[model samples]
Target: MISKNFYYQLITRVLGIVVTAIVMAFFFLKEYNALGIVVAIALIIQTSLLIQFTNNTNRKIAHFFNSIKNEDFTLRFPENLDIKSLRELNSSLNMLNSMIQKVYLKNEAQEKYYQEIIKQANIGILTLNKKGHILFVNPMMENLLNYKPLNHINQLAQVSEELHRFFSNIEPFENKLFQFSNEREKVQLSIKSTSVMLNKEELLLVVAQDIHKELDKNETDSWIRLIKVLTHEIMNTITPITSISASISKFFKVGDSIKPINELTENQIKSTSKGLDVIKEQGENLMDFVQSYRTFLSVPNPDKEPISALKLLDNVRLLLESSNTNITIKTIVKPFDLEIFADEKLINQVLINLIKNAFQALENRDTGGVITLLAGINENHTKYIQVIDNGSGISEEVMSEIFIPFFTTKNKGSGIGLSLSKHIMRLHGGSIIVVSNDIETKFTLLF
Candidate 1:
């Protein structure tokens, strides 16, 4: 309607000018000089009015766009005007401006909401561009690092030079542990990074947490578990020896007085010899258990080298296949050329232990027992080897204690294989994890 009215107004002005020009020509031809002069002046005034009218509308539109470009939604055109078309145009511009303002305000509020969440988060949050200029640093980050108003990655040096270097050289999707001393106390931070694109520019979003307390808690928990296992094993070995020794002592005594050797029967003598032998056996077993514990604590550093993942899996498969003909073993190495930088000997030991566990898990299966050795690069581009078995999976009650030394569900065996595997992976600066369900169990060695 506004457009139609504007066009109509424009046509009327043009037609009026044309008609006035025709009248002036008629008057001039008739030699009516005064009327011709009056019509000529009237034509000039009409032409000026038409140009001014169009220019006014164009200028108003230009002003509205300029205000929008400047993000100044307050520029509202006056809606009251003599011309209906101009009035409607002004009302439309005002409505558009109001709508835009609402949208802008809504966006601002949402941005603030997210910013507040980041600010209040427990973990440290930071973003930096490739140039090392810090884009954002949440309050938690400031509190964690004991630095405020961080403007650049270089500013991290104020907290710790090592931390600064770690951030500067950090790669995407990399995780690292860093320790530093602040005014308050020593802190250990577990930091991770990922690449993010914002506003068409690449940035590194770093998340960090003060894991000092968590690490301490884990260490304490590990000690408790170790103590529990050690105590249980020691008590198991010592209890029988103690009971046997007491019984043998009673055999040699009469009413708390030593019995003469001549007064003792042949039966007592035989019993004494048997009890001594049993005590010696238990003592030897206890010594072996302690030695194993020592070995678990003293896992040697890995002799790192590139080992073909395919060959590693195949070697393990061959070693275990001969012992178990009823079970099927499968090896899968993605990209066949994929390799891991680790000690072949140590890694082989870990794999063998895991495979043995898998074998045991599948032992009860009557048919279709399968143990799969899968090696490849994971989503984070980290090298990984997985031992998977289709069997009755580890129960939830046993899962948590699986990695603790001397904790085993099996009736026979010292139960240190999984624990030793975990130690080896940790020594190699990697980790071992397990996931199990009713159908399958997967143990992953990540490097």
Candidate 2:
């Protein structure tokens, strides 16, 4: 390539001759013939070379510009050419290529990061352009719609009415939500739709959050209130009969002692006494059952305090340990020394009940299966305490009723342990959720 400095020098030499000719034309007119011939030949050669150089430069410039326009970053300026200006052009082009590559890589990484973040999220996200065509859909959205995103956007409309409502609400800057349900399950989804202006075009972004569990909880609470009403009504009807029976028996006994009648009255008093005793025993049993129900209903407010988690676990272990050789308890504490606010006594009771139930679950086994306690904090900053058991796992049909009062798998149970524990956690502003599979059953306490 020719250097810029060398080209400038050649142009300088040409201008110098032109200046000399103009000077001689004015100063030496009589000796013009021989000098004019030699001067004319020198001018022709310089002009011809200048024209050829200009054409070559123009063609090379055109080719370089064409290569860049074609997006061909791999093309390079020819090496070892005599053109000096081309060297400087090559250097500039190489720097531009490096900058472009760096920008491309940076943008690629940003896109990948955005995709990973969206993929990990539980919420479903979908985006659409102004023409109502789906521009982008994350994996969560794909799974939610039950269709491949690469498929036509129209296919989504066939599966979900909530999706249709979401798309319709995107226009006019309005927010909307819809409910979707099948025979087996129901879902309440809170949906938000908004138009985003980018490069003079409007796009839509839709975000959906699942609120099905909240709906189901509300339904459960309604059922619990109904049960409370029925229990209260039954108690009201039984208390008067129980009081009347006791008073009549007392009167009969007093009359028997007076000896107003004969042997028949004595026999009647004996029979009445036995009947009274039986009535009292039955009444007391019913009241005891009612008292258990009352305790479950009157859930106490939590006086939350910060306590060492390991200490609470130790307390639970000490409280539940028995002399039975078949029962074994193992506890493993994580290295985290984090503090949390909760009702320690209530939490201890919850653990004790869970451990007791786990031990009971292994009745048929030669030796009780291991029951594991695990504690950890989730990425959402929620504290999770889990009781995992390897005993006979609960079947799916009965799993749903485990939290309901008087629903028990054991024959002699009051059926209020899990129910009471669930209420206590609710009072403490937490939750107890159970997940059971074929091999294991787990109760997760989330705070």
List candidate 2 segments past 4 Å from native: 1-204, 207-271
Q: Report the C-alpha lDDT of model 2 over 1-447, residue by residue, as the tens digit.
A: 335664785677579668756755744576776776676666677767767766766776677667666656676665455655656656666666667767767987999999899888998787777566777777877665556753345575676765555555456455556676633455567777777876788878777766676677878885985486447545654675577677655644665574345534566667667767767766776777778789888867888999777777767776766644576666656646755589887888889889888888765677757777777788888887888888779998788678877567675666789988998888888899998887878998888
lDDT of 2 at 149: 58
Instruction: Output the TM-score of candidate 1.
Output: 0.79
Error of 2 at 444 (Å): 0.9
Q: Tell me the whole-model lDDT of each prediction, alpha carbons only.
A: 0.92, 0.72
Q: On a 0 to 100 scale, what is the lDDT of residue 62 in model 2?
A: 78
Report the number of the highest-TM-score candidate.
1
lDDT of 1 at 117: 95
Q: Where's the lowest-lDDT run of ten residues in candidate 1?
A: 406-415
Best by lDDT: 1
- State TM-scores per candidate: 0.79, 0.49
Worst 10 residues of 2 by lDDT: 255-264
